[model samples]
Target: MTRSAAIVLLLLSGCTLQRPVPSEPDATPMRIVSMNPCVDTILMEIADSKQIAAISHYSQDPRASSVPLKWAMQYPVVSGAAEDVIAASPDLVIAGPHVSIQTIAALKRLGIPLMQVSVPETVDESKKQISDIAARIGHRQTGANLNAKIDTAIAAAQSGAPPVSALIWQGSGLVPGKGTLADELMTRTGFRNLSSMLGLKKWDILPIEGLLSQPPAVLLAGQANMGAGNADSNRMLSHPVLRNIGARIKIAHYPSSLLHCGGPIIIKSVARLAEIRRLMEAKP
Candidate 1:
């Protein structure tokens, strides 16, 4: 064969010799499983529904869910059980700070891609968690958008008024002191956290007597109506004394739902807080 004939033969048979066009990358969605309720709320905000195989069953529970129950019920739920996760056959599993060690070990043993997140104690930390989770699922821009919403809300709620002494009285007089997202949020909304002022730690129980001894200017009552029929849950919040001493304090209902997670909920939480603060200012 002549050189021209050989060249044509090679062109026809040796396609690999031509600068191979890089094939388009696989477009398969990353099948993600979330074993934590907090992360579930974040995923619901940043990831596509098709990407999520299952979210933590806790997100389905109204008492524990950070997101609205109606919205959360639309997704499948897993119990954070190894068997449940394996059955989902997730391409990646995201666990929260409280995920069990055994489950982590099992996932590692099975050679599954896994990522874990911690409870964000500050606003910056919460945003970072959102960014990391979105990046893992290839939704970085969505995460950034959500973060921007948080910043806008924060700016809008940024209070220039003087800080009024306030206490976040959750069910059974449970209080979140300094070093918590709640504490930081209170400051952001222009309220002095009375829990920290009383020398409380990160989380502590504030007795009724303690509250009465040095009542704050505002009371941000949380979870007051969670278990309506349960006396145990209603005891402190429903006490007659609180009603009688009402005029001395600015009482507002800050629900337990808003206290749980920080992602999208922070926007609502901050707005509510600012509204409450404005109410206090409107009053004497």
Candidate 2:
């Protein structure tokens, strides 16, 4: 072959030997499995319904999730079982930091991609987590909007009277102290958590009798009618020792789901608590 023909052949050979261009990383997850209630709420909010392969059954309960039961009923659920999750063939799995270690390990062993979210302990942390999740799902704008709403609600709530001494009743006379999201929420709503005043951290189990002796200015109960039939609330209100306390006691029924979950619904919880605080201020 002549020089030009040889050069042409070399070029053709090089072209034929070139590797194909790598495909772009898949930005859209085709199948998503949510193992935690909070994760389920976030995924539902940010991702299309068709992108989700399965969710936890707890998402079906209105009490446990902000999503309507009807909406939850429309989707299949894995209930966080390893076998069930594997069967769903999810491209991604979402769970909370508190999920069972064993389950996490099992999923890892199967080479499943897992995203673990932490529960927020403060308003700042809550905002950060929301932004993080939103970015992960390509919903950063939605997250920013939700954060703004939360800040606005908290500011509105705090604009009123000086902080009142308050107690957050979790259950069985257990109250969330300092270093808890409940405590942070109470503070954001213009209440000085008595637990924080006492320098306590986490949920402290106090005898109902002790609370009666030194009642707070306001009693904030999680979940309306939570302890109504139980001995806790009844004991707090009906206890003869508490009858003479001058402070106004009110039951703020913030659903555990809203309070416990670190998602967009936290703004709703803050708004509800603000309403309760206003009611308390109006009372004689």
Worst 10 residues of 2 by lDDT: 16-25
Residue pairs that clash (backbone atoms under 3 angstroms), model 1: none
True-structure lDDT of candidate 1: 0.80
TM-score of every prediction relative to native: 0.86, 0.78
Candidate 1 Cα misplacement greater than 4 A, ranges: 1-29, 226-234
Model 2 sits at a Cα RMSD from the real structure of: 13.2
Model 1 TM-score, all chains together: 0.86
For candidate 2, the clash count comes to 0
**Deviating ranges (above 4 Å) for candidate 2:** 1-26, 222-248
Candidate 1: tens digits of C-alpha lDDT, residues 83-183: 67766767788898787776677667556777888889999999999998887788889999999999999999988989989998877778999999988
Question: Model 2 over residues 1-284: C-alpha lDDT tens digits?
Answer: 75435434544454432322221234546677887777776666667678888888778765455666777888888765565666677777778776667667656655677778787888888888778767766678887887888788778777368887888665556778888887788888878888855555587876666666566777766442434343223234445544455444555554455556656666677887788788878877
For lDDT, the strongest prediction is 1
Which pairs of residues collide in model 2? none
